[model samples]
Target: MKFLFIAPRFHNNQYYWVKSLTDHNHEVRFWVWRKEPLENYSALTPSLIPRSSFGLPKILSCYREMKALDPDIVVVRDPRSFLFVFVSMLIARMQKRKVFIYSQTPLYQTMSWVKKITVRLMLRFFGSLWITPIIGDMRYPKFHPRAFYVPFAIEPQAQEKSPVRRPIRIISVGKIYQERKNHLLLLEAFYDSLKKSDIRLTIIGALSGNSPEYFNKMRVYIKKYDLEQTVEIKTNLEHNEVLREYAKHDLFVLPSSNEPLAYSPLEAMGAGLPVICSDTNGFRWYVKDGENGYIFKSEDVSDLKDKVSLAIPRLQEMSKNSLNSVKQFYTPKSFYEKFMEAVQSV
Candidate 1:
């Protein structure tokens, strides 16, 4: 069967899902709201095609193009992405085709009344399936009639990590955004941990173009404590290169409070590294407290630091648990099966 995917962007994990479908002997054509790839992300193959215009023109242009492509099933990223959803659903239903809405809607966030009504109306008439990547209870607020969950797939590593190294290297990957990514909060917690134990931290992410204020602030804080040797900050590593860096560390921490879903923690878990993330991470379920890793209270420096201390001794055990936990569910084979089930169910 032919599947057409339209999304705002082709994120790293997004590529894996598409790859899953293609590997299962299906044809897929991916489209995006923009033509260019993200700052540090690239498509796996058969590059993403961008929508041509804005407003009605975009809907019409894409509607015409999708009709031309003539897919067996149309899969869109989000219901909120009206152009893609609207056109895909309308056109697909017109041809008696099926639609899958890849709605990674966060349970933490509430939908506006206008959007709620709009989405319900679309699903009611056009008959689309609501598919989400975010798993566990943190998914959208149990609203969709036929909602299906598909955890984002990853290529997990088979190698297990060595025993925890002193100066237990903890790594966090995200953009340097103080308000969202919470780099400063992590730095403060890491600094507090330093007084008690010998631990090292390596931060990896992309940077804003110029006047990287948050990056500079983190640098200043490191300078203030003379921690340049222990706490290393790296920027602009490719996705695969980031995985190589993950192999060098024993722990993964994503301190962001408002992350809808993060790929880093999942990727780290897939690589046999124990993960510690904030309570609010949408994929927080992947980190089983006291088993695979810990989940600290959001923005609590002491709590975050304490979890790190607790994890130090059992890092290897948790590493095994992390591998056991993630590999069972978040694999490409799992995605292919689940996606096909959703398609057949509809």
Candidate 2:
């Protein structure tokens, strides 16, 4: 099968899918809007028409690429690529090809009517298939029959069998923003429960370019609580370095509120660390609450503190369960199998 993907940018997760498809003898090409190099995939960066210019050149470029590739399947990954997807759908219809849309955006009942109508029209008339990472996302109105769920996959690493540290190392990885990630809540919970205990906290993430205020707020909170000695805040580490940091930690905590599906916890699990995250994340689908990890109420510092306190003692058992869970459900090989099944069904 010949597959072409239209994506906003290159992501680490996409590498597994591309490699799997190629391994299965499928010719895959990626058209990315961002002018960045992808390590091993056959990816191209096409010139995009600025929105101020009415987007005709962008549509033309996409159409030309679609005609040239002539793929059996076209996967669209960004909602902002609707114009490109619409053009591809038209060409696919004439050539009897299939197109699939990868939706990671969180849809909620509080969305504007205009946005809802636009989504309905896109799925109803233009989209050939809808692929979502979470099952709950497939419950949108007018999404049956075409919607399919596929779990996100990561490359499994050889985890080191190390004894749990005495001063428990807890780590959280995400953008250092309080609104989306609720890092302050985690800080509060850590202070309330584990400050006096033999536990240390490490917050790792890139500071948002637009929001230095939130980053400053985190620094102030750390200073106010005199946690400078017990807590560490590291920013802007390379991907491999981040993974190494995960290995150094004993447990992972994700206190994010309103996340679509976070990859950090999955990476943590792959690194053989037990996870304690908010129940709001879509990836909680794999968390068997108290089996592999624990899930606390979103934004509830008290509940988070209780969950963290309970999980600290059971780290070794939970760590084993976490490894087994990733092997059973979140591996790249399993993802490829499920993706192939979905393609055959379509």
Candidate 3:
């Protein structure tokens, strides 16, 4: 089957999916809104339509491209790409083909009425929906059957046995979103629990330019609490650099709340690092508590500290379990099989 995927950007996880599907004898093409400089995704050579160039010309270009490809299925991966997907859906309908929405957006009851109406109309006319299974209490009232659970896949890396560091290196990766990622919470927990111990906490990711105030606040907190030495903040590392960082770390921590199946933890698992995350995160579904990883209460510093302290002593066993779990459940081949089944059913 020929599948055309439209996304805001071609991420490493999406690249794995494209490679997996093509390897399985399916023709896969991609159209990305923009390309990130740090991402190593030139292998696919996806067609690019810059986000700034989203006008009538781009819309017509997308329509013409879809008509030319005449794909068996069109998969839209970004909710923000509604105009592009709508064009693809129109072309698909005219060709008697199918369109599917692969979304990470949670359809919670508290969602705005406008978004609810928009989703309803899309499901009514576009095609079936595939969403992460871990979205919390979020349901499409009228499109439950059309929605299928599709987990993200990771390319596993070969395990390298290394001596564990005495300082118990821990790493967290995410944008510096003050309220959403809750990095401050993780910092507080780390400072309260592991400060005296010989442990190092590194928070790595891009600092959102839009949230400079929050970023500055974090810096101030790091200084005021004298966590300057204990905690390190690294920003804007390349994709390969991130993997190297993950390799050096003993544990992965994500203290974010309301996440819809984050890919970083899965990548960490692929690198054989045990995960410590908030229970509210959607990806917590993959974590078998006390087995591969531990889930702490969201925003609860005491509980997070307790879970971190408990997991510190058993990192080796948990790390092994983490590697084995990803190998068993999160491979690209497994994801491809499931994706094929879902597409066929649709």
Candidate 4:
């Protein structure tokens, strides 16, 4: 099948999926906002409409390019990209081609009221919606019957083995969003638990827009509590560098108060590291208490500390279980097969 993946950027996940589909003998093309500076993939080209140009010109150009492709299926990456997806749907509808959307969040729960209203409006036009199976009880089909839950696929290379390092290093990977990611919560929990124990946490990700201010505040808390050596903060690294970080860490910690799908936890599991995540709907999908990893109450310092203490002793066992869980549940083949079944069923 000829597939056109329309996304904002050709980053790690986008590149992984497009490459996976193509390797499976499917003709895959991309309509993306920017070309990744580091890698060269001849299959992808500049999107017809730059994401910056917000007007009728962008819409018509995207529509024309999509129509020209005449793809069998066009998958839009997220709800924010729905405008372009809407245009693709219009053109695809005229050509009788199928349109699908990949949504990672619950509409009513995650977005602001205004954004929710807009999402509902655009959702009415989409043929189908895809989300991760772990999205606990967000009530996806409350309005649109076409919505389905399909987990994201990790790169095959992400599943490889890495030599374990000592000193019990814990890493958190993803965008650093205050209140949302709850990095402060992670630090507090880790600090409290390590009063007698020995463990270190590395906060690695691109800080949010207000991260500099947040980081300064966190530093105050760290110094006041004397957790300077307990927690370290850093920004985003290159893809391979992040992977190397993953390989070194003994466990993955995501103390997010509110997350839609929580991609970092999945990637951590894929890399054979156990996880301790917030008890949010998305993280609950895989972090089954004693199964793969453990879950803690969101923003509850005591609860998080207890879980972290429990996790440290069983790192090796939990890491193996986490890898097993990803292999059994979140494999690339499973992701593509289930998604393809849903697409073809439409």
Candidate 5:
């Protein structure tokens, strides 16, 4: 089947999906709306209307492009977002083309009234618009009937032998978002729980997040608490290098609240690292408590600390479980098969 994706950027796990589909001889094409200078996939050309452009030009330009490609399915990244999604949906509605909303799990509870009305209207225009959520949470469909699970797949790189790294390195990989990632919570948990213990935290942040103050606060806490040597901060490393850092770590902890979907924990599990994430992570379903990892309360320093402390001793056992879960649950084949099923099942 020929598939055309309208997304913000063509970087990250989008690479793996594109590669997988093309390898299977499925004609795949994408139109991106932003610039990713890190790696140029030349075919991932910019849309006629750049994301920065506003008003009718954005809609017309995207609609024209959608009409031109005329793929079997139009995959809009999200239904809630501006620009691309509305335009794509408009074109799909006009052209009578099938739309598979490539999406994160919808947080229906916290949605604003305007957004709720907009999303419902979009769904109304196209009856039973299939939603392919990256987060594999079945509860989502209970909230919205059309949501179907199409989890993000990554190439597994489980360490051959679980090497016991000393000082117990813990890594938190995400863009620095004060309102989003909750890096401060992770830091506080580290200081309160394992300050005197032989454990180290390595925070690797992604670029493009507008939260410099949050990053600065982390430094202040480290200095004020005299945790200069105990905490390490690195930012904007290459994708492969980030994967390498995963191998050097003992556990993955995501202390964020209301995270839509985080790919880092999946990648960490793929690398055979156990996870300790907050309850609010949209992808928490993947982290099996006491098996692969434990889930703590969101923003609860005490619970976070307790989970971390509990995770320290069972790292080796949980590492194996994480790898096993990745093999069974998160494979390239599974992703492709489910994607095909989602499109064809209708």
Candidate 6:
């Protein structure tokens, strides 16, 4: 089947989804708001089409491309790019083509009544909605009547069983939208949790452009709490380097106060490290408290500290569970099949 994907950036999550469909013998085409140099990431090829920066040019280009492809399915990734995607789908529909959206976010963070009604109206036309949650408990927009939960998947790796816990190395991975993910609380919890233990923390991810103030604020707190040695703050690393960090670490923590479903924890699990995340949708699904990993209160430092302390002792068992869980549920093959199921349903 031919599939067309429109997203803000053709990297990371969007790239993964597109690649999954393509590998499954489905033709996948993408048009994004902008394109980075191909060298910015791996597994990205020359096939993904480029579109306008935004506005009318992007809408026209996307519609024109979709019309040319006449795909079996048209999927939009980012909500911000939905304006063009909606128009493209309407144009595609005019040609009797099916349209859908595959996303992890809702229409709004907390929808006002009017916005809720608007979303209900908007969703009515979507043929399918695909979401990947760490957990499957999210209350997605109404158009999700045909919604499918296809959790994030990771490439397989050799799993080394931890026989006994030694130094407790902790790692946090993902784009550093610290406030959205509540990295400040994580920094605080990491500092407090390590006070009586031999654990160390390393944060690996790109800080969002809007987070300079938060980064500076975190710096002040790190200095004040003397956590410079305990918590190492760094910038973007290659995906494998991030995986290496996961292998080196005993625990992975992402205190996203409000997360739909995050991909990092699943990747960490693939590396055989136990995860601790907020009690959000994604965490609720995979983390079975003592089974695979721990789930702390979304924004509560005390709860995060408590859960971290609980997880430290069972590090070996949790690591094993983490790897086992990922193998069972979050593989690329499974994701591809699940996605195809959704699209075929459309």
Q: By TM-score, who's the top model here?
A: 1
Candidate 4 regions off by >4 Å?
Answer: 33-48, 51-57, 78-82, 105-146, 155-166, 208-211
lDDT of 2 by residue, 215-259 (tens): 888899999988988889998776677878988898999999888
Alpha-carbon lDDT of model 2:
0.74
Q: Give candidate 6 regions above 4 Å deviation.
A: 35-40, 45-54, 78-81, 105-135, 138-145, 208-211
| Candidate 5 per-residue lDDT over residues 36-69, each given as its tens digit | 5443353344343444333343566566776777
lDDT of 3 by residue, 1-346 (tens): 8988877778776767888887878888888766765665644778775333335325555666777888888887745555655555676676777778887754333556786677777777766665543434445442345666566777777774365868889999887745678888888888764558889889887765676877787899999989888888988788778878888899899999977667789889989888988877888878989988899998898999899888888899898898888788888876877777777786
Q: Report RMSD (Å) for each prediction in the order shown.
A: 3.1, 4.0, 3.6, 4.3, 3.3, 3.8
RMSD of 6: 3.8
Q: Choose the strongest candidate by lDDT.
A: 1
Please report the TM-score between candidate 5 and the true structure: 0.87
99-185 per-residue lDDT for model 6 (tens digits): 665666542235478855654565565444544433343464433355566667787577566565556788887666456767787
lDDT of 1 by residue, 80-183 (tens): 65565566566667777788877765423356888778768767787667787765565446556577777787778877777776768889998874558898
Query: What is the RMSD of candidate 2?
Result: 4.0
**Candidate order, TM-score descending:** 1, 5, 3, 2, 6, 4
lDDT of each residue in 254-304, candidate 4, tens digit only: 888767666678778888888888777376666778767788888798987
Candidate 1: lDDT over CA atoms? 0.77
What TM-score does each of the candidates earn? 0.89, 0.84, 0.86, 0.81, 0.87, 0.84
The TM-score obtained by model 6 is 0.84
TM-score-best of 1 and 4: 1
The per-prediction tally of clashing pairs is: 0, 0, 0, 0, 0, 4
